[model samples]
Target: MSETNDSLAEEKELLKSVENAPASKKISTYAKLSGPGWLQGAITLGGGSLGGSLYLGIIGGTELLWLQPLMMIFGILMLSVIGYVTLSTGKKPFQAINEHINPVLGWGWLIAAMLANLVWAMPQFSL
Candidate 1:
């Protein structure tokens, strides 16, 4: 749709403008411009909601319906715990994970996030 493309273009521009300032600024800019995308990605990307939903929704209608929401709740809880740990300790997530958890896990998380963003976002540019 024209509207979708227009919005995506605007958001791409906005994100580009804030790309290098700082992590906080980039997050604030995204929250300002595309709150829904941020929320959707935060919650659903925990288990590949978009693609999985499209495929799963096709075959699994009412059977085992409680599982998806259950997973989402657990995902949210996990993210909250991670946030609490990072904030209470006053260390960046990457730094905390590297120090407290495994450094390789921290790097893997970072790369996966970057790749996920790139995977979905690159299509908007072609539009």
Candidate 2:
């Protein structure tokens, strides 16, 4: 336990040193940029997905049978757009949009995403 605590304290000190280091001393660009893509995929695969499925099942009573395919199509379209943005500008979609697109469009996407997240939050919050 003492050794573990000492190791953690050492790590904390290392992190503090890194934080205080000059920008020129820092290594820029690592594997972590892939994190958002994995995180987005995980959200799609996990709670958002299960909840969307259950909500459709309960609310639409099988009439939403077509919605699964529709959602897939929509997802593909959105991802394609993201791909285009990335390929064209060598930047992530959010950054590409904010940098290249109209300011209004950038803000609009932010608002739309927030609203979508809010809607998704409703069922989880209620339960």
Candidate number achieving the greatest TM-score relative to the actual structure: 2
The residue-by-residue lDDT of candidate 1 on 1-127, one tens digit each, is 5996797798889878997889999878867975465776754454445555555667787775776688679757756766776866669898988888789988987897688567654444443
Worst 10 residues of 2 by lDDT: 26-35
- The positional error of residue 51 in candidate 1, measured at the CA in angstroms, is 7.6
lDDT of 2 by residue, 54-120 (tens): 8889999899889988977997887787689867887767788889876677678778878877776
RMSD after CA superposition, every candidate? 13.4, 12.9
lDDT of 1: 0.72
Cα-lDDT of candidate 2: 0.71
What lDDT does the true structure give each of the candidates? 0.72, 0.71
In model 1, what are the clashing residue pairs, if there are any?
A: none
Off by more than 4 A, model 1? 1-54, 115-127
Poorest 10 consecutive residues of model 1 by lDDT?
42-51
